[model samples]
Target: MTPKRVVIAGAGQGGFQVAASLRQDGFDGEVLLVGDEPGLPYQRPPLSKEYIKTGNADRLLFRNADFFEKNAIRYLDGRRLAAIHRADATVELDDGQVHGFDHLVLALGARNRRLPIAGMELEGVMQLRTLADAERIRTAIAPGLSLVVIGGGFIGLEIAATAAAAGAKVTVLEATDRLMSRVVSPAISAHFLAMHRASGVDIRLGTMARGIRDNGRGRAAAVEIEGGAVDADLVLVSAGIVPNVEIAEAAGLYVQDGIRVNDLMETSAAEISAIGDCASFPFGHDGTLIRLESVQNAIDQAKCVVQRLLGRPEPYDKVPWFWSDQAAFKLQIAGLTAGADHQVARPSDDGAKLTVHCFRHGALIGVETVNAPGDHMMARKLLALATPPTLETVEAAGYDLKAVFAAVSA
Candidate 1:
């Protein structure tokens, strides 16, 4: 008997992983990977930092041409999935080809949110989300150039650090009260704000970009803040990302915050599912729908869907984790803390490392650490266990989170 065909839209991090995982699980199906971007599948995280600083495009490619062929995966590059023909169980591409699928996966991922302001069409204005975007920014970075970044989120700060280190005068304009306000604690935000400032990057908090001005050369020259103008040779808008769900919505699929998925990453429609940044799966703790854009979420969710397709009835319940490399600090987060009610910090003896414990109504929910990988690893392990150590226990153990867990288990 011939195996069924599995068609995936959006050849991004999750989409590629889904294809690879399906084959790894011994699914002898015709796997089709469709993407709008031209070229092989690549990682997006390095686009802001390492790729921008060193311009290494090769490292971003997830797999070479041989790997795709060896796995019998059909990679449809440079073609966008225009619509999903649910009744016929086929995906209509922009080039007028309809590919039938026994199972359909939507891993469309997310795109950088464009700011609505004047001079956004200027030549030097860029948004770093794809390898193409990173390449353009890499060519633009030069010594003595002034760069103004809008938004103080992870991408903005990382790009600012890279541009500043490359000899660019960088200024970050954030409308928020503090940097990383939505994710990190006030203490962490203050620490990062000082880090950027000390690195010669002018970080303007509570400053909104009203508009952009051109330098009469069709290039962005200055960013108009709330009251003043900051001169910039280039402007990078690193605000945030919005999930790409137009195809799913057009196909009559349910899309709330993102394409709603069940524990198995299955969508409301039969034979169809969604994952990665384009998917809003169930949060185990609150039973609320949550969409995560991290690589870990994408990889884990893809594996879960593949397992389900391979006759394994496993619900996706993996803990969410993420990491950001900024300057000399490595920030790691384990689990989701959206509804965290209390937070406690355990500073290291040298004051160079810190671990924050987040609790929700007296139950440990998440942990954030700066320059503390061991603590972050322990937090992930402990959070998975039936009972985790208390915040007081973590502190009383001399900030040895792992030792605290070991002692409790012993």
Candidate 2:
């Protein structure tokens, strides 16, 4: 059955891509891109990086009003999806606007997780997941401003670097022993730790922020730790994100860490599909079911679902990749490094470039690169191969990635 109408539930990157890809694929059906925000879909990454540094919202947009009109995508901004009526193949908006669909794509995305602190609701406390959040933080950043960031992950550190560069008194409080412990390797973490510190950002490792102290005037004044508190005019809670899976869960679809989906990006319901950060599918590398929060996953998964709907069903097997821009350093990862028993760290002569090759069961599985774009690009190709170069091969070649790739292909 041909899809006459496709209603996308979330208008983030993934949802926008689906609508755009469908139009590019020559789908003339009714494509409605619904979003909670009252504007065209924009890139979320720059909200913490480029947007923070330049304060230019123009660079964040994925498309303009003219593009949507030209492509025939019915974009509904500031509209929230209230319910999914799967029985009738319809979705209900919060304003009671019911729209029927032959196919429904859920790109609901995720929300910033809240800290269990007392002063969380106080003024000067912020979280950055949307344009509004970025605008809130933008007005708070200034020279000599005391800002304390809780969580040393990519978002936290990125904000810390940008704020510090902007002459703000920035301090990072990471509960973990190392920065980005859940994602990057220890060597990469140490290098970035040094980089942020050198840039005048005070990063405290293994430091747990128990609570936020309220000022006498009813705002967040300090971050209370074990023995002392870090005084701050601004507190950024970048603890992590929680997927917006409530609607899917309320509809009784299989919901785990995210909306559970198969390799084909199909939800428990055959007619409904989930993609991007909100969907937990089998990891393309190791087949370990996991959800990713990256632009690569969002765009690739959107393309995959479109292909399936267009009668060319292929397994969602794109190699996952990610990048973080903190000041001058650009850290990129080619694949999942989780559960890798062996890892080899290689660096350039000047100690500026690095690549951490992770191997599992003697096979190259993932690579973490810092300021090494060439190696990062090659790592993605290597991980995509049916037979990636082994740890021994890389070691024998003196970690010459290009040579190993040529040898493997040859």
Candidate 3:
């Protein structure tokens, strides 16, 4: 049965992509893309990087208004989805408008996790998840001002670097022992730590921020940590994100860490599907479920959902990849490194490039490369192979990624 209309909730990258891909697949059904945020869908990655320097919000738009009109896709901005009536096959809006759909897609992305500490609501303190948040950050940051970042994740580090470049006295508080400890190898973390510190970023690892000190004037005065406090004019809470799974859970969808989905992106409820940051699918090599919060993950899963909706279901098996740019350094990772039992680190002759090969039970599972795009690309190809190159082969090649790839392909 063909869907008469497709109502998609949460108009982020994944939601927007679903509507466009559906049209591309020749589905002329009524497509309604609803989002709580005003204006068209925009890329969120640049909110911490280019948008900080440029401050041009127009450049962040993923598609112009004409594209939607041209494609006959209905876009509803500033409209929140209040409820999903599965039996009625309709979604109720906060405005009391109810729309029926033959199929429903929940691309409801994640929201920034809150910092559960005193003075969280104080002025000059903010989180970076939306364009509006970034604009606030730009307004708060200035020359010679004190900026304390609350996490060592990508967004926090990126913001720290940007702030430092803008002449702000920057300090980073990471609860873990090393920068990006949960994601990258320790060697890569050390390299970035040196890079950021050389650029005048004060990094404090194993530091727990107990609370925020608020000035009587209604602004964040400092971040209170163990035994001391770091004075700050602004605070950026880039701790992490929580999936927007309330509606899914309320609708009785299978909700675990996120909305549980299968390889085809179908929710436990047959007619409903979930994708993007909010969907936890069994894509892990060990069959463990996981959700990714990257643009690549959202966009690729959106395309896969379209294929499945068009009666050409294919498993969502795209190799996961991610990148983070902090100042002049670019860190890239190919494949998942979650449970890697061992890792091999290699660096260039000039120490400008580095790569870390991760293995689980002696099988190559992932690769992390810094300032080495060529090697990162090769690593992607190598990991995609049916027979991944062995650890011995990688060492025998003397960490020459090209040679290792050639040897394996030959």
- Residue-by-residue lDDT tens digits, candidate 3, 1-410: 76778999999989999999999889978999999998899999899998998899999998899999999999999999999999989999999999999889999999999988999999988999998899999887899999999999999999999999999999999999999988888888999999999999999999988999988898999999999999999999989999999999999999989999999999999889999999999975667889998888999999998888888889888888999999999999998886788888888889998989998877778999999999899988988887788888888888788999988988
User: What TM-score would each prediction reach against the true structure?
Assistant: 0.96, 0.99, 0.98
* Residue pairs in candidate 2 whose N, alpha carbon or C atoms collide under 3 angstroms: none
Q: How close is candidate 1 to the true structure, as a TM-score?
A: 0.96
- Residue 153, candidate 1: C-alpha displacement in angstroms: 0.7
> How do the residues 199-249 of candidate 2 rate in per-residue lDDT, one tens digit apiece?
999999999999999998889999999999999999999999999999999
| Candidate structures ordered by TM-score, highest first | 2, 3, 1
Candidate 1 C-alpha lDDT tens digits along 143-232: 899999999998888889988898999999999899988888776788789889999999999999999998998988899987789998
Q: How many Å off is the CA of 150 in candidate 2?
A: 0.2
Which candidate number maximizes TM-score? 2
* True-vs-predicted CA distance for residue 125, candidate 2, Å: 0.4
- Predicted candidate 3: what Cα RMSD to the true structure? 1.1
Model 1 misses residue 127 by how many Å?
0.4
lDDT of 1 at 152: 94
Angstrom error at residue 39, model 3 = 0.5
